[model samples]
Target: MFHSIYIAGAEAHSGKSIIVLGMMEMLKAMTPKVGFFRPVVKQEDGSDPLIHLISNRYQLPFQADELYGCTLETTRKMIGEGKIDEWVKLILAKYRHIQEQCDIVVCAGTDFAGANTGLEVDLNARLANHFGCLYMPVIKGHDRSASDIADSVRMLEDHLATHQHCEILAAFINRVPNNQTDNLKALLEGSPFPFYILPERQALGRTTIGEIARELDLKTIYGTRQSLTHEVASYKVAAMQVQDFLEHLENCSLVITPGDRSDIILGCIAAESSDTYPRIAGIILSGDQEPAPQIQKLLKGVKPMRLPILHSPHDTFTTALKVNNVEGRILPSDERKIAVALGMMESYVDMQQLRGLIASDHAKRVTPLMFEYELIQRAKKQIKHIVLPEGEDERILRAAEILSLRQVVKLSILGEEEKVRSKASHLGLKLRDIQIINPRTSELRKEFAEVYTELRSHKCMTLKAACDIMTDVSYFGTMMVHLGYADGMVSGAINTTQHTIRPAFEIIKTKPNCNLVSSVFFMCLEDKVLVYGDCAVNPNPNAEQLADIAVTSSDTARMFGVEPRTALLSYSSGSSGKGTDVEKVREATKLSQSRRPELKIDGPIQYDAAVDPEVGRSKMPNSAVAGQATVLVFPDLNTGNNTYKAVQRSANAVAVGPVLQGLNKPVNDLSRGCTVADIVNTVVITAIQAQEVKA
Candidate 1:
């Protein structure tokens, strides 16, 4: 089943909350753990009444504060300051946390109550698209005609599909008049999308006296406060005489009159206690007037009837007009209305069709944000020790703090212990659970130096030279990984790539059946993660080396949960062009296919043809890996390096690695200008790689 569903609305008072409650009720019936999330709410501190109602009624595990992402003011400020991407990242992180705890989450969109509802709708669409959520738009039909409701539904679906690119599961037409239900359904029968129509019920729309009191700034004159939950089906201006007004009284009607109108007040209250009259919701004594003292004493005795009596400052006509336009809300104490809403939804909506739509779309592709989230989650499953050589660097220390706090990896930093601690303190970072080591003064230094000399004696390394080299943090950190003291090593934030990887090349060496060490960057584009190979290593390789890079890159992609569709990138598509580069790519493709026939690989394809489905079909129609290539093997280092950087800077993609492949033990490098996030991601990937090695 889907982990979540988004219920959105096209306009205000769309009755979207009914659908949310209905979906929650439906899911709760089937599963024990269901969650509710509201990404944007109107209240400043997120004290939203709907969130509270749902939480209290369902007894949800999460508190009301945890159910919403942020208030509208915060969202507006973030958008004004151009921090929308940061906002989205925060929302996704919060959503992933909830998803981890619940079997399913019902995410409701904004209420469309503010002046910027157009922007609100667009934001809702953007969130649904970003999260890969299934969205259902609720079209309001309160004052709209049947044909107008149909047009609204169609336009909303078009906007969601074409503009926002949202995967719409269905469309709900809410608050339609009972008489127009058949016509609305008939009008929408041929809709390409699924349509559900819920007829308008007065019980769901009736305002209460408490709501009126709050809106008009009224005072409680008499009776029980709990009786405010009673619904006002209709309102009447009691300007007429008692006999005539009694004839105008309807079931659960609120009477509006001056408090001095003793006859009307006494008659309504008496009728409320009589079997011959319909029950009155309440009486609103307008004009800020009070009854005579004798009548007040009479009301004190009648207070036992448990009826609500409110007093408003406005006149009777004005109070009646205000009551006429008051839109009801589902309050926490309004159980009767909620039950009616649930019954209406169960009666009108097709539960089986909705259940089918709720089934998880297994074919839905993963987004870059989701891929990053999964990487952290997977790394946290099995913690591995990763050594960082440049511990004194502020960026390294910051990254170590994050990794340490998240507990994604066990970190050991190689440097002067006090210097590392002082640097971290200066940076205001608390590096908890991170081990600090001084390579020269450490007990393991002697053992690592002796082992290094023995391993390099064939190249005429002396013990003094080996011990001196081991004092260098890079050599010491690599020796830690080589000797199985640490599972992996990440360096080069403050050193050259050669200084970082040279120790690994000499000591850890390549894995068996691997001829050379190649690197691939996990380029996280907007929609998916693509592996770009030999981007930071192997300056130029012949056909065999290129083939090895392709195969190794494919394996690396698979290890990270990405399906391998290898694309041997060149200037040509299939057999379209001839050049030295194209010939090498084609030969490499042949070699890789021969070695690993299980892999889906296509050769000599242009970048656009490899990534765009239409272009790929036009160029290479029958190739399996033409358009959906997840692993793109560049012909040389120059091309791969330039392409990955260009995409990273221009497209705003997150490049997560220069992750070295074909190594027995994991050792990854970073750019000199890498950020703290870069170091953290590299460390996480390295930990995951170590897990694979151990397995």
Candidate 2:
């Protein structure tokens, strides 16, 4: 039997596309041969937008036309002629054609087009029952109370399960209000089947200037066309005084006015350039006018800005309504919107548990995407508090919002509470649940200083000196981890590596019997994850230190579910060449082998032989790790750091570390030039490491 799932919306504009997009992503990550099929569609409308979107986004090999089983017109005609069974047979045959080449198929249910609500619901239920597919009804929850949403979903579930006898897997409630989310989810959690709630985010529905321009066939008259990607959160008619208009504007406002209004035009430019005013998404020059010659010349004299000035043939009011009503779709090119949708789904939904209930066997290979998902899921299993020392930075605040929303960790950020809060607010991020601790005003300052004074008594540290040192955010955050108030700490987004980890070194120290502290990057290539050691710490090390780093890195790999096959990297493969570096690697390999006999360790191997199976077989035919090394140990810091970076840049690999090993407490450092995603990933890894320490 074919394995498939049907995503059906209970009403029009139910926001089920988010669930479809998320499901497609999960399926693609877990399996290779996943198919997207639409059983019926409007003939006049051609292929569905979602089908086009999935095909383009995922780069599906098949044609979009082949994905459809029947047209809405054909289905209605066949049903009127009492050939419903015949229509079902034809649809089933087409579905089987698609499924024959796939492990699993996901059929998007009928869009509420050209049919009444009851008709669409019946059609969806019939299709699911006929195809033996798992049914997931998506109910619209916009402007509804928690009790109303729950009641609607329950009635639908009963209709599908008790009346239609459909295999209902889950009910997804979309557009839930922020306050009602918890109550709605709690109500659904008591049901036998699973459920997912997507909270309301109207910003995602806002159309960008590019979309509006395309819809109205408008022409760009000034500034860059690239600025058309800005989403118009709200629109305004700029027909008043500059100061009064500025006060009326909100964030991401799309302005519409007569193009000859040079005062308003110049006012918008000044407002956007200055941080004191809201950002205008774009300007629609209505009444078929461009800026006057003098204004255009003046605009050319100033520096170029990312503001689009479009000339609209219609009047101001018409232009405003048309642009405001233009709906935004999750187009293949819109990565920002896609990220937000997927992030929301991942935050609210239990991906792993949902997969267990719905999907069966998938690809066994461990891909980088799958590995990252596993990291987030694993961290969520035992939530641990992790402190971010560089909390004032925008990247740190953005990552905190993601981690907080995902419920991946218990986060406490160290900075001035008001400063962090204001920064988060300016970025339009919500860190309401995240604890912001000001190092100078926190209650733990005295206790932390006392502990530090005792720990640093040999260095002549007094209570006053300790108290002064505790005021540093890094020191305060590290102390939280060391004192067991927080489980771990992640810093260095803005600070130097030394500033971030020095506190950990002085207070947390090393684990038992581990003298050297080194670092490794979980270099996630396209299909596999490899460990590269001593890339961030230990500029140069002797044989013993190198061996300890290797063993410690191996333990870390195994701790994260990667089987450790340690390879000592050098310029030569096996013993074919001899030099100081090769000799050092050979000695380190021997020491590591003796220390951890169970782990597969090979030495003096070139990067090629350590990774490529063919080269490995030619060079070292007898070694277990030569062909399939998951961990590589560098001879010195200079070689390790440059090589990891070169590979990362040239190969487009996601280098997710310099994860420090041999630490008594779990403290990891971020790259100064890391992205928001990097910070989030590092925080997740830190939380997982903290779980090990607590265990």
Candidate 3:
């Protein structure tokens, strides 16, 4: 199976040819047979230099016509004012040949050969459809106007959507100006595609051992970083015969020899003194075979030469090509992108976030409705009654007993005293330092009546009704938060989001100036976290509502140690296309910026523009929020829900929320799909939020 991917520019001058060659040189370590297939080459005057490089340098077997493949010009002419059937067949044939032998194929495209309507074959679309290869569009990193770039991306997207049947796995923005990249990045963030912004670096595919050593803090006994230059060449093969190998070693940084072939190793050293190439960095021996003793000793001594040897089990041709695929290699640029991705993922998630994500499904990771109860839990810098709704349940009783021992919280249970004790005893559930209340017989304290009467009048409720509602756990929970009876309240195991919040809202309400309540779902992945908002409320919010959502989400993000870079997502970017959805995102962005002038915000961006630098550059070059958007605010619930799910299923992103927000107190809902860990995490998050509120 192909282990890596490589994409070249659309035009010959688009820099596809050199990049392919450069990738081949650097991917020398992964495998020897880097598959070479030009899906569409227009030149009729020349034999493909790439084919010769692949066959001769890597010693890859090739039938003459197979190596040359189909020249796209004849096909383009034949299809355009002519028949396309034969051309399609010819294209498919070449694809099979390239796909068969190589572990990775550097797919090349015709500059603009198929762009005309007379021949309706777009080079990018045809290549993507016929070969089923990952699409990696390469663009020039020149000082091109943003309008031109945006137009180009639109054309590409339109072509791909119509004819291509593959993902734009990644993109490469090459030759970008140094000082202008930041400005370019801002523009890219508002696009609707996925891409990487590759800065000018030493070598494309091949990385210096020194750079890796420095990054990993590895002890490098061989190869000095200072002595190294930026250019690294790629070869398709380790050696042809022992004879052709020596001449090929000229000017090569490393002689990538096959592990099982001692002849190639012997040949490389013999040619070392030839002053043709730079000193070999070392040998990246292909395959898992052990080198002969004499050859190993010879390699060890080459006088003052620290010939570092690396190994991979694949054939020399395959390993060599992979070593040169810059796209797969983690460069410094990629590290930054990955780091940002990790940070976004981290900030987007929390315990409540996780609960909201997993709460909706029935495939449980653990028991349903699991909860934590404490006897003397701390609240508001003082110990107060912490109610256990399921007072007679053994789990609650046992939790109460342990919490009491620890003086964690003042425990209050609602049940007949005899029943509570009997259940605890029968289940061996300890209950110590606990207080019990019975609705039928418990005396109403003076303060309870006074506070209840005051709240009753405030809410326009009858005194009797108010007192009765006050005894209900949900109602009492809200009162606990409001009346300082308890620092916080937690009770939603058997309730819905509304049930959990209604009592709280009715009694506590929100503090002054808090307009609309919102929710944030923190999607946590193994390596990162993500914050999704309004997933559980305001199903189809207007632009104004969305703006509010963005503000609340940003605040929530900051509360969780994340620096928010918000992306307002929509199907269209800017005012280029018309849609209520796009308008919502655009307005939300405008409102958010106006509301919080200091925030780093951008919007009317697609998901790709929000995260992929290359996509952002191509589609929205003037955006400050593109490519690097850490927080994504969807246009509406449908968009948010579907997009989040698609990303979760397709990109392996873990969706973790609908963490309820905008409540007077920290009361979140549990998805019926929650796991025990999800429950635990939510409780912890709620506790943290509650603690902050109390402070």
Kindly report which residue stretches of model 1 are placed more than 4 angstroms away from their true locations once superposed: 1-359
> Model 2 — TM-score against the truth?
0.82
Residues 260-316, candidate 1: write the lDDT tens digits.
Answer: 999998898788876688778889998879888998888887635566889888888
TM-score of each candidate?
Answer: 0.53, 0.82, 0.42
Ranking by lDDT: 2, 1, 3
Clashes of each: 0, 0, 54
TM-score: which candidate is best?
A: 2
Candidate 3's C-alpha lDDT? 0.56
Q: Cα RMSD (Å) per model?
A: 23.1, 4.6, 25.0
Give the CA lDDT, 0 to 100, for residue 143 in model 1: 76
Which of candidates 1 and 3 is the stronger one according to lDDT? 1
**TM value for model 3:** 0.42
Candidate 1: count of backbone clashes, pairs at least 3 residues apart or interchain: 0
Q: After superposition, how far is residue 205 of candidate 2 from its true place, in Å?
A: 5.5
